[model samples]
Target: MRATTTLFSLSLLLAVSARNTYRSVLTDCLNTASVPILLTSTTGWADEIEPYNLRFTPAPSVVAIPRTQAEVQSAVKCAHANKIRVSVKGGGHSYGAYGLSGTLVLDMAEFQTVNLDQTTKIATVGAGVRLGNMANKLFSLGKRGVPHGTCEGVGIGGHATLGGFGLDSRLWGLTVDTISSVTAVLANGTAVTASASQNKELFWALRGAGPGFAVVTSFKLKTFAAPAVNINWSYTYSFPTPAAAATAFQIAQTWGQQSAPKELGYGIMLFPGNAFIVRGVYYGAKAKYDALIAPLLAKLKTAHGGVEPTKSVKTLGWIDSLTDLAGAALATPARGYDAHDTFYAKSIVTAESAPLSFEALTALFTYLYTVVPPSSAQWMIIANLYGGPGSVINSLPASTDPSSTSSYAHRTAGYVFQLYAYTANSLPPFDADIIPLVEGMVTAMGEEAADLPAYAPYADPELGQAEAQVRYWGDGVARLKVIKAQVDPMGILYNPQGF
Candidate 1:
C-alpha cells in the first residue's frame, strides 16, 4: 500500500540518513536556481514560524525566501527535478501540516508587494503578502477589498484558496469572487496563469482547492472605493437550552434575509455558554442600519434582559477596520507550544440538519473545553449565510470549496458552519489528550450532524478510511481525484489533502 511505503521510507530516512537529508536537499535546490536563498538552521527560523494554533510545526528542512514570480517558478522546478516535495508557505499561518510538513518550503516572506490599479480598480498582490498588509496598502490608495475574515496575518494565497469568509462575505462576497487572476507554479514545475480566458479549469480548481495543487505567485483582485469609516457593534446574550439557541439563531438569519441591506453584514456565534453573540457591520447611515436591526433587537430585549439596544461604535479608515477586527493590539504572537487544526465543517442550512447540528455543537464545545487548557484554548464556531449579491458564491459558479458542491448527493442550501479550535499547549501524549475529546464528540453526534463539506486546507490524515473520506467530501472527492490525476499525475506535490 502507498501508506505502507510512505511509512517505510520515513523510517529508513530517519534511521540511515537523518542528519543531512534536509540540508542536502535545500543546498541542491538552491544551487540549481543559482540564486541567493535564506537558510535558517536554528532559533531564528523557529521563532518567526508561528501557526494560528500550536499543534503544527514547520518542517525541519531549510526554507527559501522568493521575491519574484520567476524565483518561485525556479524553486518549484528545481524541487520537482530533484524529487523533493514542495510546499508554498504564505505567512505560515495555516494550522496544519500543509504549511509545515516535509520537503522544501517555498517561503513567500519576500513576496510582499501590493500594486494597485486605480484606473481599473484592480490590485495585484504578491502571494506572500498578508491580508493585513494588503488592507493597509489599499487604504493608502483609498480603496477597499471584499471580505476575507479578521486575521491580520493570513496571506491571500491560503485564505483565497480556501474560499475566504469574512465580514464582507455577507455583502461584497468571499475573497475568491473578487479574484481576477492567479499566477501559480504547478506540480510539474511549470508556471501558469489562470483566469476566465486562460486555463479556466485550473482557475476554477485554484480558487478553493487549497495551495498544494499549485503555488500561487501573485493574485489579481478587484477593489472598491474605500469606506471612510465602517461601523460595527455586537450584542451577546445567554440562552437556557440548545433549542432556544437554535431558534434565536434562526430568527437572526430570517431577519438578515428580510431587512439587512447589501452594505450591511453580520455574524451569529452560538457558544456553549448558552450564549449567542450577534455582531454586525454597517457601510451606510447609522440610523438606516439601526432601523433595519430594530426588530431583532426588540425580540432579544424581550427574551434576554442582558440584551441592550445601546451600541458602541468606532469609526476608522478601511485598513483600521481590519486591524480592529484582528484584535491585534490585544493578541500577541504565541510561543513555546504546538498547535493543529481540524474542522467539523458543514455547508448546508437545511431545517432537518440544523437542529441536530445545534445540539451537537453544545457537546463538541463542552468536550473541547474539558481537554484544551483555557489560557491556551481559543475556538471559533462561525455560522454565516451566503446567498445575497454580497455572498461569496453569488458571482462565481458553484464548486468553490467554501461554496456549494453540486457533486454532493446530499443537497446544500447555501450556508456555512465552521468549527475552529485553537490551543497553545503541547502536552505529553498529545493524541491521547485531544483525539478522544474530538472523536468522542463526533461519536456522540452520530449520523444526524451533517452540514459541512471537505476541507481542502485543513486535511486530516488520521481519517483516511472510506467512510471518513465520504463524510468529509462526499462526491467532491471523486471530482478532486480526477483533477489531481490530470494536474499531478506523478504525485510529486504530495500532501494529506491533495491528489
Candidate 2:
C-alpha cells in the first residue's frame, strides 16, 4: 500500500510538471514581440524545425519567426522579462541542436533580405539570408563577395560569425574581415549597433565571438566590385602508392608556395579511395593564369596528364563562378546544400615542420580511409593555399579580437586546412566508426595538433567550452570575458562555449 501510494504521487507530479512546461513555453511564445508563434501541429512546423545537419531533433514548445530587427529585439526582451529560455535560429545549420533546444526558438529565416549600396559597395544583409541567395542576388547586381562555404544553404549568421573561408579568400579575405557593422539584440533586450568606431570592444568580440553574445539582427559588410573569374582546372588522382601520393601533395604545396599567384587559389584533397585531388580558381585573366600554373601541369604524370579549362566559359561572373565552385552549371541555378560545418584540423606543412609532415599527414589520411569507408558519403577536406593580395591576416595586431592563429601556420607565411566530415546517413557507423578515427588522428598528431587552433564556427562542441575559447578568442579570451560580464551579467544567453 505504501509503494502504491508513492508511485501514484510520482505519476501525478510528472503530469503536472509536463503541463506546466508546455503552458509556460506557449504563453511566453505567444507574447513575443512582433513575431509569429509556431505550435507543434502547425503546417510546415516540422520542416521549420529541422536543423542543418539533421543530427538532432528540437524540443521547443513553440517557435517564433521574427520578420525584423525590432521583432528580434522585442523577442529577446520578452523572453528575459518572462524568465524563459530563448534560442536564435537563422539557417538551421548548426550541429548539436544549438538554436532549437530552448523554450522558445526565435526563427529569423523570415528575415532574409539583401540591401546593397552600389555607390559605396556595401551590403546590409538580413541575418537569415543564406549564402546561395546572397551570392546569387549580389551576382545579379554585378558584384560578388569572398564567396561562402561550398554548401549552399549555410546561413550567414553561423558562417560569418565563425570566420568564413572560400575560393576568393586568398585574394580578398575571410568573410568576417569585410564586416563593417552589426545590429544585435543583447541579453537585457536592448538593441545596439557595433562597429569599429562605436562600442569598439564589442565590435571586436562580435567578429568571431558574436553568436555567444547576442542575436544578430542584421550586418553591414564592405562589398567588392564583381569581376570575371577563371576556374582553370579540376583534377583527381588515385595513387596506388601512399608515398607517391604524399610526394605529389608535398610537390603541390611547394609549387603553390613558389608560383601560385595571389589572384589564384589552389585546394588539395585526400580522398577515401587513396586519391589526391587538386582544384583551383584563377582570379586574373586566363592567359596569365595558365602561365602561372604551368608548374602544376608539369608535375602530373603522363598517365594523369592534361589541363581542362572551361573553353566556352573561359571567364565567369564572380557570383556565377562561386556557383560553379559548387559544381553547379549555369542553367540550373537552384542547386543548394544543407550543411553542418566544423573543422577538426591541425597545422599547415612548412619547412620547420617538414620533418614530421610526411608521417603525420599520411597516418591521418590512412586512418580516415580505415574508419570512414569509401562507401561512406557526406565529407571532403579543403586544403586552401593562403598568402596573396589579401594575405594580411597574419599581420593583424596580436590583440585583435579575431586574429588568425597557427593551426595552419605551417606555411612559412600561413594557410587554412579544413577537414570536411560529410555523412548523408545518420547511422551508428559515423559516431562509432568515423568520429573515433578523427579523434585518434588528432591524438596521434599530439603536440603538433595542439599547436593548431580550431575555427570557432567549425570547432567540435564535444571539446566543451574550454577548447572553444582557445580556438576563437585565443589570447583575447580575457577581453571577451570582460565584455560578456558587462553586456550579459546574468548570463541569460546560452553559450555553448561557456564564455
Q: Among these predicted structures, which one has the highest lDDT? A: 2
lDDT of 2 by residue, 1-499 (tens): 9999999999999997986775565566566444677777788777777765554667776778777777777777767766666777766766555667666788777767688887887888888887777887766765556445665676788777656677666566667777888898888888898887777777777777776677888888877766665664666776656555666666776666566666776777766666667787787787787777666767755324343322222466665677677665322211133333322233222232233366665666556556643335445565776553344343344444244321121123344565655444543233434455446656654566555655565646566687667665566777778988988776666656646
Clashing residue pairs in all predictions, respectively, total 15, 5
Q: Each candidate: RMSD to true structure?
A: 5.6, 4.6
Which lDDT values do the candidates have, in the order given? 0.61, 0.64
- 1-499: candidate 1 lDDT, tens digit per residue: 9999999999988965854764676577686786456455655676555454445555546566676777777777777776677776676666454665546777676777688887888888888777777877776775656567687767677788766767766666677667878888887768898886777767766766645567888888888776666777678877665455555665676665455656776767755445578876777666776787778888777666455644556655666666777777312222222333422222223331243345565555455345443444334556565543344345444453454322222223334555543333433223333444334544545565443444434444445545444644455667767766787776656555555
| Per-model TM-score versus the true fold | 0.80, 0.84
